[model samples]
Target: MVLSQMDAGKALTAAAAKGNPEEVQRILEELRVHPDTLNEFGRTALQVMMMGNAKIAGLLLEKGADPNVQDKHGIAPAHDAARTGFLDTLQVLVEHGASVNLPDQNGALPIHIAIREGHRDVVEFLAPQSDLKHATVSGQTAVDVARASCVPHMMDALFAHVHS
Candidate 1:
């Protein structure tokens, strides 16, 4: 029996998780699976790209995946990419219209997650695009997280945006 679209989507998610860009490409091309197809966890292919390489993210974006689609926790693909230090992927999502200030279920912004994960570059890239004053679920702002974590670059980025 032929696999349904949902099965193909699951396969795409698996391929992405394993960093198998070719398999993802084949599934997108051959199976005609949706680029933004949601897996069992309600995470779209774009969210899967968060932990994967830049190529897969780019391919998914090219195929029309919505960067803003959130997972079960309300964390967008941009949040995951930033949290995991996937700089290029984060950039692509941002360029493709992912809102930097969009918060997750925990109300944590992308910059907050970046700083939490010690991904300074991601924090720097996102800070300027976000409001440092926004608070998270834990009652902490981006500036607060940066300071508490002692991430100088993140702190500097936030201050620059705030003072500018």
Candidate 2:
């Protein structure tokens, strides 16, 4: 019953995975945990939220969790959100100063990850603000990744954004 006694990092991660804002805030208030604590895999609560927890992501950002923290894989929280096409999460991170251009270990930016995953809406959202010519691990840009993944709409969107 004592949420404070629970592992704050674990609780935060679980809350992030569940997108439970209330539980997350409770953990923060009761546990006095560091919001940016990384898990064994080097993922922070914000990163976990970016993976799929829009509510928790918003909460964490509103609570002042660092938006620029990277996982062990060197992927920023925004990158994870973009990779998963979590538009709301991405927006929250962005509003909190998450760098839109941070690259992952493979040199893939958030837009590149979104394109590789064939997330058309994410690509559409990111395209206007991104440099589609940016390269990745294999020297491929978002358009190249979209083309290889057979996502014609993403490729077209990137192309249009880059050209226009």
Highest TM-score: which candidate?
A: 1
TM-score of each model, paired residue for residue: 0.89, 0.85
lDDT, candidate 1, 34-69, per-residue tens:
887767766667676537488888788788888788
Pairs with steric clashes in candidate 2:
none
**All models: lDDT?**
0.81, 0.77
Question: Whose lDDT is greatest here?
Answer: 1
RMSD of 1: 1.9
Q: Global lDDT for candidate 2?
A: 0.77
Off by over 4 Å in 1: 50-52
TM value for model 1 = 0.89
Model 1 global lDDT (CA atoms, 0 to 1) = 0.81
